[model samples]
Target: MHEFTVTPYAVEGDVDYDRLLEQFGADELTDEQIADFPQPVHHLVRRGIFYAGRDVDRFTAAANCGDTVSIVTGIGPSGPMHLGHAYHFYHAKYLQEQTGAYVYIPLSDDEKRFSKELSFDEIHKHARENVRDLVAVGFDPDRTSIVVDTADADVVYPLAAEFATELTPATVEAVYGPPPNVGLGFYPAVQATHLLLPQLVHGPHPTLVPIAVDQDPHVRVCRDLAAKQRYDVEKPAALLSKFLPQLGGSGGKMSSSDDAPSILLTDDRETVREKVLRHAYSGGRSDVEEHREHGGDPSVDVAYQLLFYFFEADDTELERLAADYRSGDLLSGELKRHAADRIADFLEAHQRRRPDGPISEVVEPYRLTDGERDQLSPEVFDDV
Candidate 1:
């Protein structure tokens, strides 16, 4: 073999590569980590529901490809979920109701970690709120099935091990390329079995793990093992979403843990408004005359992001306001106030719909018994 080349590029300040990675936040997944999935209707995406990445089309094509139609979706309860998480559930519920697919939802308790400074007990406790939030987002009681991994820590391991043994360590190491932790190796098995849980929970069925593309590596691992299975785990479909930015910065996914950039699922009206007005990036100028002449940056403007991601107002109404804002007539204060008021009001309405619901409450009523059966809905399947 040729000697390894140490190709040099322009050097910045003394680079402590590991320290720099720490200084700059990033995920470990590579460009190829994501799987290709079926493209669901754009409206399904806009409603903030069911998401997988490149893996979606395969699931869609398979459903039409064969006689069976069943799906699997797993949730990570490692941390309390946010509006971002709500999107996935809403979409899953929609697909289940429409298609009559056997639906499986797994709560990933084993994967949770407390704050680096906090204990596991704290993280464990937070799982309840996550369950509540998921329920409130409207997972139906009659149509869905649920499993929480903590119910029996070993419940998932047997299946996961079966998947790993079949897929082999060499195979996993080849696909994922060892790094981060030994856990990632098994994470694929855990993830694969999760998508297959509906089949495991009910019976032989087509399963799909509906999730955001950020979790794509997990799906690739799942698809690989499924292909090698005694059973088929057709490529899990991924419904993807664009990441929402922090209120104050262009980088970093929004977090439930932070107060400033975040307007949480649990935030009260005033807190919502205050967070928006105080921290939202603006589309208006620093001063009046210059702002009117040049307008502002819509890409960085927090209010605009909310309007695009969360607003329920007519598209035309939103479009008119966006045009005016870009023209410099709209002040940042005015836009922030409008967005905060609307977002707070919308969240309050959602909270009211399921007064007693929380993720745990949601998961409890929908929990599935092994060998249980439910009819699939016809709505989820498209004739085309």
Candidate 2:
């Protein structure tokens, strides 16, 4: 067995995803389960960007039958949002559109504070920018709620406190590795609070958390807490995806902290092209003539994988591109240009729709309602 480590806080070395599923004990999504998703499924699901899951059947059943369903996918405000972050949120929006699933997005500034080198001011700034990008995704305000951990600590903290009692220090260290600070020791409880927030507000309902496969430990720990039956909540199901490989071809998760430039949400056409052409790993032969004879390998081509994973949604068209690449008809430069163009197009639309105004004003409508705050933390409210 090749040694690799995957924790919510870090993913190191090349991950064996099949082995990861076994280690995490999550079920691979079956064909039948895929069929259960509402019609016109997002390409992410169809193409296996999201490959494995836990209790997906129950969430699909709820969606199929018009029962209350919620999606909880969050971000730590450690940096600007990148294409990898957009991938998860965009899929959540697609499901919300199809099934009218309530969507809850949490901005874990607290976690960022504990985990990153940034100050609270810096973290909050990123959180605000992330909110703008999220609002631009166009989640239905009527059904969508966004919570910032510190901004909404009245509810978040109390709820996390309730779950913290159930978490042992050994278990936290085992899953997340050692905590850098006391805040991290309790942050898993905050994550548990995020997963179960939908149920806390609207009563028990099927909730799905779409996240990277490495983050499954967070879902598993939360599931264990829910299973204790202290809270009136059902365990949240998870949709796990392989990492969106970084541009450097390391096969690790795309991250803003990487040495190679990440395709940021703010990148313009020229910036996108520059990054893709300069940094994207090529799977072609050393010489152009050799590449023409043997063809490029799309399996290891960063550009092709980008298009296949999320940018190129058309099944037939994507397959045609793949065939052409494998047959030496598509050169590495041409494929990189194509992927950059597609990515730029997507970002253009997102930038156009991005919300403007004081972050406070823009976020108020999406924040938890006063009544919900009271419900989740009457003691805190009473103190106020």
Candidate 3:
């Protein structure tokens, strides 16, 4: 068996998603399960970008029956928001729209601090910016709650503390390797708190986490905690996806830390084009005559993959572009520019909706309400 790392803190080397299912004990989503998703499933699920999952049927069944269902996904505030981050959130928003599922978006500022060389102040700055981007995603303010781990410690910490008891140091080390400090050792508990948050606040109903495949370890750990029955919570089901390829044409997760440029949510049309044209790897041959003779390979082309993964929503149009590229009628540069234009259009609309007011005012409506906070941590509420 080839060894590759897949942990909450790190993902390296090429990933075999099928093997990941075997290692993680999750099932590949069947067509029937995909169809069960509220009518008109998002292309991500329909096209199998979200390939594997644990107990997806349970979540879909709940959604179909109009039972209380929730989607929990989080972001680490070590860097700016990128297209890869937006992919899952958009899907979450789609699910919320169709089924009225409660959406909990946790800004893991504390986790970022423990894992990265960032000051708390810097992490909070990123968190605030991330909140603005998330707000723009248009989740129903009434049904959505965004919690920053440090800012919402009154609820977050107490819940994490209780779950922390179940996690042994050995388990943490085995999954994440030795932590640099005590804080990192306990971060998994915080993550578990994130996954179980909906049930913890509203009582156990079906909860699902839509995340990239590398992050499945966090879901697994949290599921174990829920299975203990130490708290009145159900294990979070997962919808696992392949990494959106980096612009450098690598078969690995995209990252802010990578040398290849990432297209940030804040990038402008010109900047988007600059990055794609300059950095996007091409599968077309060097010479025009050779490219026309051999055509291009969409399988290894980063530009086409970007369009396939999220940008190009129209299936018929996407197929035309793919077919054209493979026939060498669409030049590599043309494909890159086409993807850049589509992405810039998306970001422009997203930026237009992003709150321009003070962060506190914009985030106020969606913060956990007093009563909900009390449900999670009455003891901490008294001190606050």
Candidate 4:
């Protein structure tokens, strides 16, 4: 395929304070908190923070080893699709197109138990909405597929069951929440099943999952299951993105539920600008004059973090901003101004280039007949 340069980089203020709340056990964070989890283990992998302890070289070589590369990602229509969500998919699209990897997206209706109250039809409606949103982010229908978990014939579920049987609960808890939900207890199994779906369908033998840091637990679960698979599951790899903090807070990260901290991808440019200027966390000089003269603390500024993802430029520009802002030459307004422009540019470009329609073509579950489903070994479903 086409090769896009993948580089090591950081976005300023990409810290997700609310998400961090779960990580640090902090109830609240003042404007001063700026640190994030340890740097992602692999610098070369596109967006490394979200990945577990994977080395990029191994992934790169795997991409090389495969006759065709398959990159897997999933989404549940729990809420609207935001710019933050696009970051992960866009990176995947770039890497997939560059590496000639086929993008396999699971529409993840099966996991919609989160909105279980909704009728199957209603659940599917939102799932469809999520598909349009992803298409808007530039996925090529011909290149990408969307698989609905519920519709898959027995062929996929049996594979999924066998896959789930391999994971242990301790492994799941280690990579995710403290008091794990019973739903989450089985999360790894489902995740591994998703990763391997393509393989069962005559696609790539081993696929990779790309996600953000918060979803690291899923991959952690996969890694653990891979060890036990002697031959049972399709062990997958992943790429993780670091979380970007809210507009102004530092405690945790942008949470789907916290409207105050996020600038939704659907937000208009003017609204985006307003949020960044007024709400984006600031690391500038305490006073307007001091910040302009001394330059801003890029570390503390949410705008910088967002720009790291939106700017599409090298680090030198950020350093320049740092120098100017510290000297009182670059104002918070200037940072917001640039951030707004880049964000606006990104959104518009994405809208203009959004994919034509539903990724259903790419994600259609591997259909199986009743006979095939019945043929599945009962042993595969043994509760782990």
RMSD to native for every prediction? 9.6, 1.6, 1.8, 9.4
- Total backbone clashes of model 2? 0
User: Ranking under TM-score, best-scoring first?
Assistant: 2, 3, 1, 4
Against the true structure, candidate 2 reaches a TM-score of: 0.97
Residue-level lDDT of model 1, residues 250-347, one tens digit each, is 43446555445566677789988888888877767889888788876666787877776655436687777777788888877888888888888877
Mind giving the per-residue lDDT tens digits that candidate 2 earns over 1-384?
678888888888888999999888998888888888889878899888899999998899999999999999999888899998999999999999999999999999998888878899999889989999999998999999999999898899888988999999999988777888999999999999999999999999999999999878889999989988668889999999988989999769899888887999988999999999999999877887987899989999999999988899999999998898898988999999999999999999999999888988998889899899878895734554
- Cand. 1 Cα-lDDT: 0.58
Off by over 4 Å in 1: 1-52, 58-73, 114-120, 152-154, 170-184, 201-206, 257-259, 355-362, 370-384
lDDT string, candidate 4, 1-384, tens digits: 222211111123334434543552323311111112112212223222343324333445655565555677877665667766776677677666656666767766655563344456777777766666676666655556566677653445666667666665555555554432465456457667667655544443446676655555566566666667365544565545555566655534565556565766667788878877877877777778666556777767778777655454555786677667666787877787888888888777766654444456523332333443455424456677
> Which candidate's lDDT is highest?
2
lDDT of 2 at 81: 95
Every model's TM-score: 0.75, 0.97, 0.97, 0.73
In terms of TM-score, which candidate is strongest? 2
List runs of model 2 lying over 4 Å from the truth: 380-384
Q: What is the alpha-carbon RMSD of candidate 2 to the true structure?
A: 1.6
* Per-residue lDDT of model 3, residues 278-313, tens digit only: 999898889888888888999899999999999999
